[model samples]
Target: MQDYDETTAFLGQWGRFQQVVFFVLVASNIPNGSGVFSVVFIADIPRHHCLLPDVNITEDWLHVIIPVEVIDGEEKRSSCSRYRLDVVRNLSAQGFLPGRDVNLTELQQEGCVDGWSYSKDIYQSTIVSEFDLVCSEQWKQTFTSTVFFLGVLVGSLISGQLSDRFGRKPVFFATLVVQTVFAFVQIFSSSWAVFCVLLFVVGLGQISNYVSSFVLGSEILTGHVRVLYSSMGVCLGFAVGYMTLPLLAFYFRDWKSLLLAVSLPGLVYLPLWWVIPESPRWLLTQGRVEEAESIVRKAAKWNKVQAPQVIFKDYSAHVDEKKTPSIERHSVFSLLRTKTLRSLTLILCLVWFTLSTGYYALSLNTSRLHANPYLSCFISAAIEVPAYITSWLALRYIPRRVSTICVLLTGGVSLFFIQLVPQSIPSLSVALEMLGKFGITSGTSLMYAYTAELYPTVIRNTATGACCMVSRVGSCIAPFLLELSTFSKFLPYIILGTMSAVSAAAALFLPESFGRPYPQTIEEMCQGRRLKFPCLPPKQRSKLSSRELFESKL
Candidate 1:
């Protein structure tokens, strides 16, 4: 059968039709960026202490009712506990001063009976402040994010199949509505429970919209433009959205306003349902040949080219000829049937899990670092823009295996140095953390393309889905891992650094997939034959050593 690329060549690569689809579809990813990282601001916990109500006592005396506790070797008032207010009031009436004549620690203490008072220096309000999710309720803050990712995990497993069963355009637009509506409703959440439930629904929509758009763009565009739209275009849009979050959060300090600021932009996508067409490839799979032909003709018209009637006729005839005996749909079990595939699958799983954990651990923990939270988040998001750009350049010039390994190792090395940096030099520590983020982001971006190149087309979606599901397991654990900093400041970094290092080492065992044509079957992959670079001269290829030869091949 002739490839779709051959029949669709008349559509014109990078022409008007492809450009419109590319930019329109890529805009969908920007809101997904907000869904993924917005939790950093929404659930932020500012400095807080116990609230002491007036009991005919002076202001300074009431302030002294909250006992000071040693935190990181510095004295700060306890957040959850305060001295008995009645006793303190009596002492104040007798003109007894706290710590001067009265032994404050020896006095009776209890939980914050009058509730807590949060410092509004950085954040004007957050879920933490609004819902009193501090002290004994602090774990609720982290759990909110975990619940959102749990929804993402569920969505990733089903969205691909749904898009295939239905249509990309419908599923994409449907999920966009779900995301926009839920995000808007969340702004008026009556309680934390309502907010969390809304967040989960929004997460379901977020991942679904992103995946559907990705599939649609890949199926509609032609040649390198298709590849670039998948990687650089959407990836940069996501980064731009992520960077936009901090700026929005900075201006709209209230959690509700911030939520509204991020959500309302999704409404701009409402009109795209009419503008973007369904994937012609997906239509062919469902045997809707006439509809696919109509789209192809439209694309040709937009590109200012003539649609050859013979091309569509021949394509439809070819697809019809193999309708009964086409390749059977492969299951997840098929991936594990062969030894090489099973081993490769396991290695990829580890790489996915470890990379995801380390990536999110750093991402979610940004607010905890000693700096302006908004500035830190902006820096964190801004750094990824260049990282994705560098990843694109590396994929073109460097071997996939080499680039993946180097980037992972760079992240691991940065994590190892993070714990070693002293508290006195917080600026240096922040720089190393940003460096680690850059490395992890680049590796993650490359891994998406590398995994696609490693698998055969028959089981590619199944394999990708399984690996993505496993990766979400890491994200589910990431917030909890970050919560462990309360126990030991170095623990999260140490764990992240260790996992990244091991994954980097394991990457060496995988085969190079740089310039090689993607294997179309399981047997072809097992053969492990590295193809020669089409552009390289035979003399140069022959002069290289075994390792250099592998790199030269792509």
Candidate 2:
């Protein structure tokens, strides 16, 4: 049978139907984009010190109660501990004022007994402030992100197979509703435990919707339009959502309000269930020929073109095609069946893991950048605009392998030089970080397209989902990577840089899939990929072949 693109040729590429699906889907992603990174600001660790008890002393002397500690290479008032209140009270009662007769060095410190007095300069009330996830409880803050990712991990594990087993459009709307509802409900959570539980539930749907939408768009759109949807279009939509976060946070300046407001946009997508069609390519894989034909007919109508009366034809798998594919419906194990496939799976797993870690690490680290958190986050989100656009152009023009290597290395090297920059110029460090974000963001955008092209329709969602499930390990660990700053300020950068740089080598082995059609079956998948190394022994007199050795026991 002809490829879906060829089969549906009359339904013009870049026509009105495609345009609606493209933009509506992209718009649907804005809320998701905002939701995914909401934790950045919602849990922001504002400038804070222990709350001071009311005393008959001037406010100028309050700094004396909070002992100076060197944190992240800067001497600042300790957020977790204050000088012994009894000692300070006694000193003041004895007419020995702060910085005069009392030696602060001699005083012992105690943990905040009253509570924290968070600075309202950045956020009025973040989860960090409201939940007191500070100092000793900082692990809660990190764990909160990890829990959400664990939910994402679950989503990754299930969404693809569910999309493959059920259908992309149904799963997309279902997961989107879950994500939006749970996230909104989380805003009203009265306690941190309740909030984290809801966050996990929200996560269950978070990546599910995203993966389904991405796969949905990938399969529905064809040709260069598919490439644009996978890379620039989808990612730019996400950037818009991400960009919206800081702006919302800037106005609300409170965690609950910002997150609550972000979820409202998701409600607008409810009526769009009819606008986006189920992926015809996916339907063809499932043998839902008639339904697939109907959707394409609608598409054909919208494009004002004629579709063939018989849109699909039966295919008794050819000799070679029959040999290449296993089951019409495949599970995750299908990935490990052949040596080439196993190798492909492993390399892509590594690539996904590293990219996720590096991308989210840069993203989550925005709040930590030595700048205004809102502006820093906005710049971080804004950088993706160009990163994705340039990435789309690069993948459209440059070899896929070259673009992947360059972006990963650019991000890696940018991160490497960050520690070398003098702290006196924080803007320089921030600029380097954004450049790093730029590269990773571009690389991430490129990976979505590249990975989609490398697999067949039957297992494409499964392949992508499984890779993402493993990637959740990296993303889950990302928040703690920031905790490495406790060891050394530059330690996190060093680790992120090294991972990004080293992982670039994996791209060397990936098939350059630029301008390639999405593989429709296992046979097509194998045919499209050529091993970089021709290491197989010269064919034996018996005529053993490379493809034979890869797929079957010789």
Candidate 3:
């Protein structure tokens, strides 16, 4: 059979058709980026304190009613406890001051029985404020994000196989619709339980199309074009989406309004379903050469190039099953069918899990930065633009393995030393935080192209999806890791830093693919480890193609 890109070479690498497909797929990722990070604002926790129902304690006596405690080395009013209302009212009637006239420590304390009063300075309403997810229920806030990532985990498992089994275009649009619809439904959710359910489904769609887009772009574009699309193009789109999030949160302080704003962008992407065609490479893999040829012809026309009379070699007439290993049933299990592929898969899982966990953990921890959270979030997102650009340059000019190690180690080291920076210099803390973000963003962004190149085309999506599946485990853990700051303030940084360092070391084992051709079949994976196939090029086959055309029967 004809090589996938070789057959479609008439379309011209980096032509108008490829460019259009690249931009549209990248643009479609905007909402996915925003939706994933929206949790930062949606679950925001503002200043809050206990509320008393019946007797008027007077606003002047608000401090007296709420007991003060030393927390994080600062004397602040208790968020969950308040002096007993009866005792406070009696003290006020006696014209007694809290500490000066009466011993405050001896006062009885009670939980926020009447409900808590949340400050609206940072947010008018959030899931945390509206659902009262504070004190005992505070864990629910992080759990909500965990549930979303859990959905992403489940979605990653199926999205790749679904894209590989079905066409990339259909699966991408289908999941995009899933994300858009559920995001709308989540706006009107009355309770936190219902909200979490909708978020789980939204999470499913958020990353599904992202995976599809990655595979689709990688297949459609060739050479440096593929590298650009996979690395900076898609990642920068995500950064753009993320930057908009803080602006949306700043404008619409209510969580529902922000969801509505982010979800609206997906409607524009629906038209992209028709604009971008199914991947021609994917079409050829299923033995639908005629359909693949038609798409290639149209692409050639769009690029203003002449179409070849016969786009593909008549593989059905020539392919011999006895001469080639069977890849017809290459499911997720194919990744582990051989020892080399298995080792590649496992190490990739570790690299992906570690890097992605740090990436998202750092992303989620934007709120923890000392500056205005909105500003901190925007800066975090903004830094990714340059980071991805730098990544793109590195992918083009630098070796993939070298770039991977450098970025991961840089991010890890930066984050690891954040604790050493004194609180006296908040600027230094923010700078280290941004440096850590930059390093992780650049590293994780490069991983898209590196990992995609390591796996063969037949199971590319499946391989990527499988890696993403384990990586989502890290994504799920990120929020809780960020929450570790509540204990030691620097605990999350230490863990994330350590993980990034580990991933950098693990990346040492992965083979480089800086100037390699996309692997056609499982046997052709990794140039050094080609199995049962010639190093130069091997004939691609289809067991059903020689019997009958897959399209004609359908």
Candidate 4:
């Protein structure tokens, strides 16, 4: 019975057909990068203050009507309240100048009677500016982003089941359309509520399309092509897309314009519907043998190989053999059915939760860094290029446990020290912040490969899915974490740093999966058979082989 791999071996490794699919699928991820991180610009709050109505005072004395407070170590006019206009007018008429004859603090303060004034130097408009989401309403900014990620979590959970039932190509295209249409609709939204609802739908489509593209590529590509597609192609494409966000935001400046600009590029991707093909593997899984055969034949012909007359023959028998191991399929709850699995699941969740939270916290804070928001965001996104490359190298050469623990620790240490960098040297703070992001980014990339390796194949998807969902919970909480800065300037960094450090320590207890065969069952995991290095004395090796020979003879 020939497996799909044996049947497709004649198509040759890294052929033109595989190359086409690789590039096309990788191209799909470029837009996803933008969609994922565009929130940085869309929700950023600019410098603002309470608006002062028509007063017969000079522009230089506008400070007389507003109180100043130190925020993040900078003396800035307060955002929420202003000195009573009547008092200020009476004082100004009496020639009672601010800081001269009168005490500014002594004046009664009240909320902005005429609304707020937003600084347009960096941004022309954002959701914060559009909806007055500042001061007491600041939670709305972070909550909106959380709502989007919540949508991502829901979308991720359903897309897998939907794609399994409906086929990969249809779900992929449907989500792509959903993403495009809703993204555009967000630009036209008349209110924040409408915009947020659209944003949630956009998040749904974003993850759905991304997952479909990934699954399609994995199913269709064979051998090293699949590895490269997963490790380098998709990650680098995402970084490229993320890097493009700052450049686009720099040009568009206005929130509406930036949203429209970044989103319209997805429309160009629509043409891929005509050229890209469905996953033949998915087709076979659904018992569409003829359809699967046609795609395989097309792939072979595209690679200049002769198409086989019979494909997937005896596949049912081979599938039965393959299916026997998983006949008693376990649900996600089964991950905790054993003490060992339960311990591993809990540790993995903590690790995933911290890494995901740290990653997003650093990403969302990019705009707040003491530099040009665009440059800061670009640096944050661009750094992931080298970070991912470093992670790949580490995964190849170093032990998985060592690499994961070290990366998390490095991120933790960097974030812990960021609080110590004196405000006198803003560059140092920014540098440390970016360094922390670099470490977390490397760890984030490593976790996907590392976590999958740790779980046995039967429950691997379920275990990883549960852990990833935990990460989304982290994602949901991160923006709110950023809001903690309102309580204390160093609180967010301290909290994220603590999370990183704790997770790194938890990683030490995880079994190392490096250079070892993946365990096939929960029993193998419970036995801890494959977790150790295979070192043995020469005498021991000889004795073991001799014993095996004697047993075979008996």
Candidate 5:
């Protein structure tokens, strides 16, 4: 295979291919909004019980029905009665009954009641008089939701490492199939245990969508385009998912329908096996030069250009030759040995952790916002469009260090102000929230680009994945953090803000890689050197331009 200086050409091919790939990958993340079901399940109906009209009573069984207004002030067509008799009948077959095994507190927690608060009179008179059933089994619904996230956290870390070690396309294909199967399986689950297990599997597979998408986009695109395209694509998916979640919850009140609706779209990705190519960059790292060359040729063909006779050589071959035969591959612990790399990893991890925690907590807590939850989520997400655009512009024109530090600092400062401002001024709070969203989104987007630039190719994915694992740790804790008392509503935001600022400070110690070729090995990275063409011979050394030296080294 020939080597060509075809970075520009490869980039053009990447630009066109990424659009189609982006759509399929984005759809896979829709299930991430499954929490919308939990919210809708609780909030849609009131807790009050009103008498049912024209109903006959039977002596053998007692009937208690709660009339819920689906459309306000329209009783004839929009009002429906949730019957406790049906619940009783269902539970009776399972050896459970109403008052004997179930309590008012348990029913209220499961959203079986009709009002915001429990009615003591109705609870004591009607509920106690009804048949007995064990309500503790209903807690499984909450448990399933919690299990889904646990699966997500574990799946994300595993997918990240596997994608780096094996390849993105394989993981993408495998996960899509698994996600599709699990999604459909939930629709027919007979027990809560089965539903929870299936949901966990679905979450586990769904995480690969984000990990593979980000890694694939990063591998193909260069510089500002990489940052802008990757972040905007993912965030756009998130926004769409968020908007669609409530609607899905409303339309498919049953968990089965909701799971099917979200999971079915993932099947479209299965055909990607034919379209998505294995990453050429990854192939080069693994010393599969022939395979890398073939992919590069195909990429050039897609771009309507003839392949160059001598394309870029595989630099990994040379690096491997220098290593001692006895030396094993470095573990995650070895990343900490380099002072600069260690600081970069720690800082990036902190920033990702902080950003994810704050982002999710606010997102989940949107229900508490005074305005409509759907509209509020839409507005919050809309603000991110400009944030991504600004990130692209800053990365393209501004110095890498300045752009990163400024965005991080701005996000932190805005978060602090959000806490100081009073919620009584709803409009001001909304404005500040938008500002905070913009800052954090911009900072988050910038961090991906910055982290990629800081690391040499050998351990790039591993390093990024390790940092992502740390971020997931924060995501795991976000729920508990947000559940803190209302008096300390600002506590999580304050912590997030401080962490972002600290990361920005840490970014100061890292070297900038803008306008420079990516380093292929740790030796090449630490030497701060570039490749230069031989004025004499392969063994001879001579002074040359930095870019020329870097190119020759590669």
Candidate 6:
């Protein structure tokens, strides 16, 4: 790394401009807080309506029962008598109930009920019934969810490679344009197939928003400030998305309108092309040291400091010789051989997996709660804002490993309690769910910061991307896992909690990097074995030094 005084001069107020653009870009990606669209499309539930028989209810229990169908021999079977009390009440208000005991003839004459029994001998053989929805088909709904994640998976895997080849600024601009076009097209989609295609393209572009913002933020800030700013940006964006989604859903009941609300804000950032700077670190890596220096000087100038004479330093020699040639050529396989790197990759992957599973699983299951889905989602999301802030405070005072372990352990503990909490006590269940949200959110924010810190500069982006790919494995499994069993409600939490605890234990095996400068090369990272420094007394350093001194004297 280049050796220069800490006090470097800055140029014109480009830093402020960069920060503003960063904030806007980050905020625009907050997945519509109204979450109605996501629930309608991604969660695969649409046109949920059911009829109740012989039940009197109030308005408070609306939306209590969702209709479902079972398959019988060569026919579909359905039932409304299976409706929960809450569902009965909801349908009663909506005119989905029978005033007295009515057979199929009475229901058919009234024109309120549809479908026929397949078996003529109702008592002799099992009769079949099928529930119908007024909205889209189930297969179509599943396709939309699949396409959304596939977009995320592909976009994430491609971002690092694309950003490295083309500059971060270009990638940012291109993806923004692509996302805007696709998002708008989604508004006009006539079928689920068309919508999925549009959403996939939208997903591809959205990844650019995140990767570019993170790269820009890291380049502009220094040391712990880098971690703090990036984590806070993400957390704040999520919190805003969560808080706003409910209101957006309430106002714009139509899914298309909600998509428009989320997509339109992103267009405002396209004009930021003039302001956002290319990554200076990336510039230096590509051997454009002079250009890197110019960018750095501009940043310094903006901070009201004078730019010092810039010197370029090559720290590449310190990297393990074996890993160097392959990495320099951008070989993905090289990351597997380096033990330290491999360990870092595994730990990061586990962290991401746990976070995504816990976060999305809870989000998808909000429909199971008695309270308003919008309100519950909002509260769960609102809890994360404070979690991120608290994580920032803890990172400042505590050692990196300790904070990571604590947060993971906390999430694990909360998840375990979720299994024990009776569903009958809705209030307590919601509270515990919120607590789990807090722990997982805090752990996730910290993981992003910690993963960036652990990787060497040579393959930082690649390593982070690779770990994210593993996390997608968890994301892909999450929906299926959630659907496996009726008793599987707490399964995601259990799996996430256990994985987080395992990651926390693995963190103990990594070096403590607090107060120490970041290691720039693989060699520097691997030079010493990791140990518990926070638990060690300060006098231990003095004792070791004195012992060496006495040995030299002897």
Sort all candidates by TM-score, best to worst. Answer: 3, 2, 1, 4, 6, 5
Candidate 2: lDDT over CA atoms?
0.83
**What's the count of clashing pairs in each model shown?**
0, 0, 0, 0, 26, 17
lDDT of 4 by residue, 459-507 (tens): 4445555676777788889899987888988898898889888898898
Model 2 weakest lDDT span, ten residues long: 545-554
Off by over 4 Å in 2: 55-63, 72-74, 99-101, 315-327, 531-554
- Candidate 6 per-residue C-alpha lDDT over 1-554 given as tens digits, one digit per residue, 9 for 90 to 100: 23221322133323564566457556654652332135432232332233444456744333323223453223322333333454345456676544432122223212124322222221111101122222333444434555666676677667756776566778767877877778877778665566768888777676655665666566555655565665676657757866777666556545566667766766676777777778766654454556766777666665656565643333222222222222243434545654555665666677778776776666666655544556665676678789989788776778777988888788778877888877578688678877877887887777766666665544556556666656656665666566653566677667767877787787777667666544444443443325222221345333433212211111
Instruction: Give candidate 6's TM-score.
Output: 0.75
Residue-wise C-alpha lDDT for candidate 2, range 378-429, written one tens digit per residue: 8888999999999989878899889989999999999999999986898898
Give candidate 5 regions above 4 Å deviation.
Answer: 1-146, 189-196, 310-331, 529-554
TM-score for each model: 0.89, 0.91, 0.93, 0.85, 0.71, 0.75
Better of 2 and 6 by TM-score: 2
CA lDDT of each candidate?
0.78, 0.83, 0.82, 0.77, 0.58, 0.58
Better of 2 and 4 by lDDT: 2
For candidate 3, write residues 422-479 as lDDT tens digits: 8798888789878988988898888778888877667889988999999999999988
**How far out, in Å, is residue 535 in model 1?**
30
Q: After superposition, how far is residue 229 of candidate 2 from its true place, in Å?
A: 0.7
Report the Cα lDDT for candidate 6: 0.58
lDDT of 6 at 443: 76
Sort by lDDT, best first: what order? Answer: 2, 3, 1, 4, 5, 6
